[model samples]
Target: MPYDFGTWDRNCNAEQSQPLTGTLTGTIPSWLRGSLVCNGPGLMKYGDHEFKHVFDGSAMLQKFTISETGMTYTSKFIKSFAYTTNTEHQQIVVSEFGTRGCSVTKGFLSKLGSKFQFDKMFSDNPPVTLARFGGAYYATTEAPFLHRIDLDTLETGEKVNLHKLLNLNSQCPHPVTLADGATVNVHSAVGPLGPRYEVVKFPPTCPAGADSVFAKPVKLASCETRWKLNPCHMHTFGLTEHYALLPEQPLTVDVTAMVANTIKDKPLIEGMEWLKDKQVKYRILSLETGKELKLKVKSESFFYMHIANCYEEADHLVFDVTTFETPSLLHQFKLENLRTKGSALAGEVDSGCIRRYVVPLNESVKAAPEENLVKLPGAQATAHRQKDGTIFLTSQKLSDVAYENPVVNPAMERKPYNFFYGISGDMTSNKASVGKVNVRTAEVTRWDAPDDVYAASIAFAPRPGATAEDDGVLLVHCVHAERRRVSLWLLSAADLSDIASASFTLATDAPRALHAVYMP
Candidate 1:
């Protein structure tokens, strides 16, 4: 079924900065005193120059502050050099993933004048997901730039160029911030030594008075990748208490193609290719030693963008990740494609499912090719040692429903957790509902949305003095464009029941966001 995602493509208003009061429909927990800050594409067009892809929109920071009185809304376009320059010329000036920045007033959007290379036309649009680089929070894409923002003031602050401090040309957008105030992320560098993928750690910095945390990275654990010129795309990686799990999928980014495409005035995704013959490998980097374990673990090719949860046992390394059997996901989110087929493709859309894979970290043991190495009870996944010294991994589906943006409690991260929450959907339907999955019971629960409404990514916020892992709230952003309204639905994580919904019908520039974080 084709699902129309036109409602999710909302544009920013004329205001540079403004706080709007939103109407509340239900009671907000008095103890829930914080903000749900979201970042995503908020501006799709500039004057006559319209963006060509879904990821090319101007970055905007939208906030929903929860107070004792009621819920309020505010937003600000990230004041990056790209945004300012585009606003100054009233046209698209910087190139993005699938959009070319060209000088054209009235013409085909993709056929604009060019000769804009990737490095020369590099953009500072960090509209994907927001994370703490070190001292402060910054809006981050997969690029080398982090656009800093003040959560309270809705203000864009100093922009940091990450490439200046390290040999990193690009950093993965999903930076996993651990409970100890440290951040674990991966960066890829391509130079004379071919390509080297490194797992980096950013020690927590005092956000109060620290001027710069550029030197906060204590260690860079380099992991070996399969490709040299065309490294696999690293949109996300999994982390455990002891190691960073780096996945090398078959979907690779062709650097030569990207530069060539840019010269031809084409979008960036054109440079990406899916090598069907390649097998996926999960490389382990020991956090304690700050070194790669050099494990030869390979599995059948599968494409993924998010990992739900991961933890390490004495003998096995277990992790849950959203998987797709095909690499067609790369082209599914194009604006033109979404207009027709829409964005309703679920996990099973093409063998898309949440899979839990278990690997035997103790590589010394000898086992037959048919012998399953997983010892945990009720375990369906297998780790069999091949004759070629490769431990092959095979996984079975964990749930029937799709947990696209899988998130676990912050406290339970890098540890064993039973329940995880995310934007869930049915395989036969296009509409999305927030879902919670229980790993032990093999049960899935969901809070479906009303008709004519869209629910975005869901985040797990733990309650104060929480007892259980699911004892908290789930924050999700929903948009009903036909009604000119947006809302924040707070659901009890324990039961998936709606506690309250704060709806804003004031046209307060609340667009559907990519990801959200709950700060209390």
Candidate 2:
């Protein structure tokens, strides 16, 4: 059987079931002892109705425990308020980021009620990423709250309300933990005037002494846009030792338009307007002082979904991202497009490429715009110095293949690192493979999946007390199209060689995961 992109949406119904043990193939590393946890859309339909977008599916958490003997697998749906309501009522009563309610009246009432009771509409899908913070594991989405899960049981715990805990409206699932064990993430809040962006830091452990009284997150930096509108749709941000980078794309949300669209029972994605003429703005904020520098660059309008890694050099801040030419990629995930196989849906969406951008920093915020500004060949360029100093901007394309879900060594984050491992494929192709790129050099190493299998993202597990940087193992989840089977492959990080694999049979095809994490 050949690969079918639509088969990935088949419901697995593996919710809150007993652990299925699988036999290991190849040689298992004696030192590899821990669990790998991943979360993504598990249930695509409720009762008789099916979700229009993949983002609307109920979040399911999957866990695989690795020991010397064999591997044990378990999965459960995150019993979020939205998931429970939908299952109990047999309908989508809550509105998601992309999927609206079942009826115009119900959608309007749900939106109205959300303003007073936030949890009623909160979709704790936690499908985006898995994070370990403050000595506890959390399943997080774009929502303001983080759903705590048991590391061993894969069961849902109490929902941590970020708004009440840190006065944050919403937070990105991708967070960077510092060397001192402090986890940091970017949060955004929209207001009548404009949107405010904040960088928050949470300590390793609760300093407040009680679970109920968690320590308040410390604000590292913040900035408000002047447009009185949300500055595009941001999935992740870049971080360095001394600076935080936020990319303000041309795709923006108008508060007035959104409110009106909500009343009319339209999907939230419909209200997003893409301004092709506007240049992308990169906001650089100093971690030490509350100073901000803005650099506007001109090029074909594009959107960034993930950041690979970022670091600082002499007087420059550099980062890499997977760039899409437009926002049409979101529309490609519609059920209608997924159902149509062959060339109709394949090679239709633009594949994303990894691009690197360098920004030179200024010492003072009031420096003249032209004093230290340097423009490279591109679309358009505007450089401005912050109160502290001036900064310049430049960019270059790095990889030939489309890359997404990039990951780096956790110890090397916010610092200089060379190799980056991620999922690579053509934007027009449905197949995916694992590839590692050496940033310093332009060389890339790839391990293409068989034509009958689709590969997901790779997670790096660093060897204990290792000396070299790439001295670790890469874990990837693969799904076979013919048998509807799922398998976990462990490869050598140095050369992409197959080290071991654990295969298991699933009742239905396993949905593709957006991201994964390995806990050792």
Candidate 3:
């Protein structure tokens, strides 16, 4: 079966269930009966069955659900961390590092309540994904390293160098060339790994790739600065955690530079897209042998979208694809394609079924938009696939959002930082919308929220006794237009429609494209 997971974030001052009571399955909390109470931080604090915890950067945790008895408040947790020091970018944080440590309300309450200032163990970069191994949690960090933590005891552990496993330093050359017989110490870095933005692969000792987290990550291959001079380029895969997929972004230089010192008007954006024909390839690496199986696809017809993992009675994989200029489409495949015999045609995997969805921008809205029209190019929206094969994708239809900003991309003109150089669209927006896609029917539905509401992060809340038509709730974390004020919204999973909206406080607003985790 194919599945797509989605989330919801809304704006409103609503009630919450204190002293959370009830049962939780998967990531959804069952709310009993309770009086309508004002909200606090949405964190799932575990005090006296309260289970309160503040999401990182949030002033207060937004309660997601309450039991009819007012016993439990289900919530989600978004974390940030600091890693080791690197003076190279001054912008990269390295202090206060820890796995699943930096949270919003905790950052604030620690200051006010005289708690152990847990903010110090911050990660150098935000975490992309976290895996649990040997009772410990291992998370990938921007400092290009993975940190280990004790899941049961919440204790810190060893750190593994991700750059080393990817063989970045060895595959790419050092001492980048400079003018006047000089060289600058330059090295390539690995991009984020996950569904849409990173390399995809199954971790360790898992029978099926779908629904399995990376248990033990082994190195596959590496690249020099291919995407750009620094190449903050990230890739995505189609198979569940089953296969390791690496897309190629060729490395180019100042082709016109060797001839004359004349300032070639060649722009960086154009440089990144130079070889539109060079296809994005992937490698399926054996966690045991370190041997890689390569696969190439028809680069022109399909650009990478995201990967979905399915683990029902059988294992399956879904790859979301879109043309360089088309709607997002999903392609389904079998998980066997990653193995030796079955993977021979790795490059020949079926296009399977295709599902495409595009946010209607040019169309007129029944209600006048509160702010300036939402900028286009939200084309960079992210998606989450639910276990039931439904897909929820955020769209660029929110108001007050700047779609393309010249100010943010000034570095692209001069070869700015690897990742930031090519970043388009304004992630900042008061309002945003999410689209729902049915893998079986290829049908599409949409839900839009208020302006200044930042709900880029979404998730699927566990449902009970509900069918595919009425089984799940979409959970979203939204920052209100007022700023520093965050809220939550529960949406019916089946139709991508709103259920309820609640408001809470945050120490600071969350970064636009951050990750959130749902704890049952």
Candidate 4:
């Protein structure tokens, strides 16, 4: 039998169930305390209206609190304009990443007048992930609007649009938090100098009463895009002790198409086009001086999904991230493709692998076009100066297995660390497995999922005073695809072994989620 994709068509948060205890199939750790707060797509469709892409669903916030008293689970859908308006109208009234209202295509005449409904042409639903800014939690997507939600009750708060403070249309969902409580994220904006990207910082403090918690953001650095009208989409970036590495991949957002699509009553994602032949530019920004280092770093084009870690080692900046050979990863995720492709959907993303890239730190070093500048030992990566003044980066696979959402110990972030855990979108197949990877040895140890079980990404909670990097328990949100059930599984981080003694099963099958965080 093929995998069931029915969950993609259902709204998982229609009912309210909270403080529900799990019928533990395994024993949960007695010492575990705190909560696992998660956010992702939940409400995928409404009356006569359905989202086109998996990411087009409405934001669903979930919480699993672990204590000696046992576990409790609660889930609720965020009241974004997309969700409320669609529910009020009994159809999709707003345009999502790839889906628009049927009225959009009723006739060319209707589309021409959709210009008057430009407000309905965009959406603020944040189904991507949970982000922390200025000591407050928010559900964030690629859009400028972030829906603030209380971490304890999952209640929605006032929305903050970064555009109100800075002229940015899109914001990176994955942001790097600094030691001083400031959060740094990349933003895309177009001004007098055509298209450009900026590294913006939101300090820990906020005004007593303000419209935006991110008002008066400090622009660390900005760079012009290669194209005059299009800017490469940035999902995430790399941050070291002193530098922020921004990858300008070939996948771009066409500004002209976006405005035209809004006026034409078309989905915004139609403006996004992937240029596989374009080279990836690595723009290095100095953290201290808030300036761009004039280093022409370029590499063969590839789509980067997430940066696991970046650090300075031996005068070289080393970074690791999940890479896709082409933009097919995103293209293959359309709702129609997921329902029809089913199990094959897992194989589409299996081509993604973790890649290690190294860049030379010296500002004024001259080398031959073919001479490798990376001298750090045991690193199979290299950087050679090209004849065109471009420092070409060549990377090596950190592990043989392909994975998504590669994560490490939070304490070991932005520094060298071994043993990173990974989870797959489809764990029922043999193509990808939930496991741990040894970066130094390139050794992968996996815990294969049983039949009909799919897994989310890995979240870690470290054991107290533990010296080993993988000392705590690993948490994974698993769906029993056939049994119509969802649960939180705990595994011994020391080894990817199932801790049958300490896991919690949800009252019902959860809507699909891409990422989660362990709050201790």
- Model 4's number of clashes is 8
Q: In candidate 4, which residue pairs clash?
A: 26-500, 26-501, 26-502, 27-500, 27-501, 27-502, 28-501, 28-502
TM-score of each: 0.92, 0.89, 0.44, 0.92
Best by lDDT: 1
For candidate 3, what is the lDDT? 0.31
State the lDDT of candidate 3 residue by residue for 203-287, as single tens digits: 3334354322333332333333333332423322222222333334332333233112112222122222234445443333332
Instruction: Please give, for residues 330-440, the per-residue lDDT of candidate 4 as tens digits.
Output: 667788887777766654554667788899888346687778889888888889987778899998887655567778888888988887888643423432358688878
- Superposition error at 217 for model 1 (Å): 1.8
Better of 2 and 3 by TM-score: 2
- Per-candidate Cα lDDT values, in order, are 0.77, 0.73, 0.31, 0.76
Q: Report the CA-based lDDT of candidate 4 relative to the real structure.
A: 0.76
TM-score of 4: 0.92
Ranking by TM-score: 4, 1, 2, 3
Off by over 4 Å in 2: 1-3, 103-122, 190-193, 209-215, 294-300, 341-343, 363-392, 427-430
What is the C-alpha local distance difference test score of candidate 2?
0.73
Q: What ranges in model 3 sit over 4 Å off?
A: 1-123, 127-129, 148-159, 163-232, 240-244, 249-277, 282-296, 301-305, 308-318, 322-430, 464-470, 507-513
Residue-level lDDT of model 1, residues 285-327, one tens digit each, is 8878878786789888888888888888767888888888776
Worst 10 residues of 2 by lDDT: 374-383
- In model 3, the worst 10-residue window by lDDT is 416-425
